[model samples]
Target: MSIKNITVLGSGIMGHGIAQVSAMAGYKVVLRDIEQKFLDKAMEKVKWSLQKFAEKNKISKEEVDIFYNNITPLVDLQTAIGSADLIIEAVPEDFDLKKKVYQELNSLAEKNIIFASNTSTLPITELSKLTDRPDKFIGVHFFNPPQLMKLVEVIPGIGTDSKVTEEVTNYINKINKRPVICKKDVSGFIVNRVFIPMVHEALYSMERDNVSMEVIDSAVKYKLEFPMGIFELADYTGLDVVYKASYEMNLRDKAVLLLHPRIKQLYDSHDLGQKTGKGFYEYKGDNYERIDLTPEKASKYDPYSIIGVATNNASWLIDNEVCTIEDLNIALKLGMGLKMDIFDFFKKNGPDNIMNKLLELESKYGSFYHPNQYLYSIK
Candidate 1:
């Protein structure tokens, strides 16, 4: 069955965006929060975003009214979810809080209604277990700013039915988003599985090599042609968000991937990137001026070392059957907006060179930098 009505739980950053996208796609969407103030703020943001779209001709001026009308804001949970064909929970990333929400949703929601969480790094299997309908529960992780980001990671828990997976994938497509299936539910899924470690390695490089944040950011942005440097994106995404995601993933792997202490220091100080007006680099409003860091200083730290560690982690994911090579690439390209073929770089650099660099990093950082079996098999 097609999803006609979608209920977006929570009216925070992700929730509001998800609701807007669903409404824009012509689905009747209920944007629910616990408080009227939060609902009002979400609505205001949606209106401003819709107006921006209209000015850009992304949506017609007349269409703005149609889209806005499609979204209904409510504080009452039962009233909001009563007719929902699908409910996407965009709540805060707290285990107890999510479990409690699902427990209550189990009683309030219809038996057949599909439940999806927009969790970044949490296990779908664990979240599914909290509800009565494990087979119907799945993860529909939309990248930040769901209205613009094209990719959605559709993940199925161990108990999730294949049909439920197919339905959720179809619904994501209907909303004009590309769906990359995470065949197995693992912490960090696919995009963050590869992306987060890369950023963490960047931080480690800065710490070990004694390079400035600007040096690392400039090299990654200029040399690698990424849209934003590591620190720049971290600030844009909020250091606290990244730290929390890393901390959650660390819980499963005995802390193999640890956030740099500098990141934790920034997070603790509430200097959370663009949101808080400061992070790794200072920002003037939404604009961050590049400080003209020297590429010579950046060259002191090998870019390939960081790239190899991320690639090895990607290979590890492949080795474990978390996702196929094709799925992982698509998730990174579409979800993280890498916009380049990750595997092609391996072909260009050659496995021996990549492996050698990884080995060098491994000597300094231990097994976390060690190449996975897939890297070994790559000849």
Candidate 2:
């Protein structure tokens, strides 16, 4: 089905950006929120973002006006989604709240309208069960800043129609974004599955090896060539978000994913990273100035220890047929903003060396670090 009219529910950070992008792609977008004030705020943000794009020469001033004008904000759900051909839900990450929204939409929306969730952690398959049109329901996991982030993870639930998946992927491309198809609707999908585990390992390294966060952050930034250190990224992403994502993934796969104690403590204390000015580190000023990580400190910890865990998790995704190696590599590079392919370590170090590293990590970190069968097969 060709989607011409899009309805973006929630009109918050992700929702507003999704609406703006869809409008930029020449789709009529209805941005909906429960309150008029939220709709007003969302429109202001959308205008500001579009103006920035214009100032940066990314888009013409007239194009910004056109894009900004293309979005219609509304508070009433029935009026907002009445003419929508596709609905993308970007509500807060509450399971019950999302289910409630779907229940309401199921009754109000036409059966033919495709429903997509911007959920970062919850399984698409489980969410599809909440609606009558499971075949039309899919997950379009957009990164935090939808306006800037290029990668979009297209996840089709087990019962989702292949045709629907293709249509959504094509729609994503039309908006000038990269779409990596995730074959299975597992918790955390591709990027987070690989990322969260790597962060957990970093925390474990700090706790077990007694290494400082600065050393770990320095090693990750300089050694791994990541734009930001693991802790830095976590803080930037908000510790509450990280903690909740870890909690959700753990609930689904407790054996392999565990929430680290430090994450929980920071979250409980409400020191949620850059937004709150404190998390793994402290942030000061309105712009949230970056924490300086010294390059010399990179030598203190071996980054391969963390890379080994990421490699094992990526291998697990491949072995389980969750996503192709090509897609996984693209997802990491685009979604997680990795400077290199996730399996570059496995390829450079060879499977045997990686296995030995995993074995060593497993002995120190428990069964979670144990290598998947794919690594052995390659060996």
Q: Rate the local accuracy (lDDT) of all candidates.
A: 0.83, 0.88
State which candidate has the highest lDDT: 2
Put down candidate 1 lDDT per residue, 270-352, tens digits, no spaces: 99888788887777756656556666745655467666766777787888888878888888787666657676656555667
Give candidates' CA RMSD values in order.
1.9, 1.5
Off by over 4 Å in 1: 288-300, 349-351
Candidate 2 lDDT over residue span 156-184, tens digit each:
99999999999999999999999999998
Clashes of each: 0, 0
My TM-score estimates for the predictions, one after another, are: 0.94, 0.96
Candidate 2: stretches off by over 4 Å: 348-354, 377-379
**lDDT comparing candidate 2 with the true structure:** 0.88
Give the clash total for candidate 1. Answer: 0
The candidate that achieves the highest TM-score relative to the unseen native structure: 2
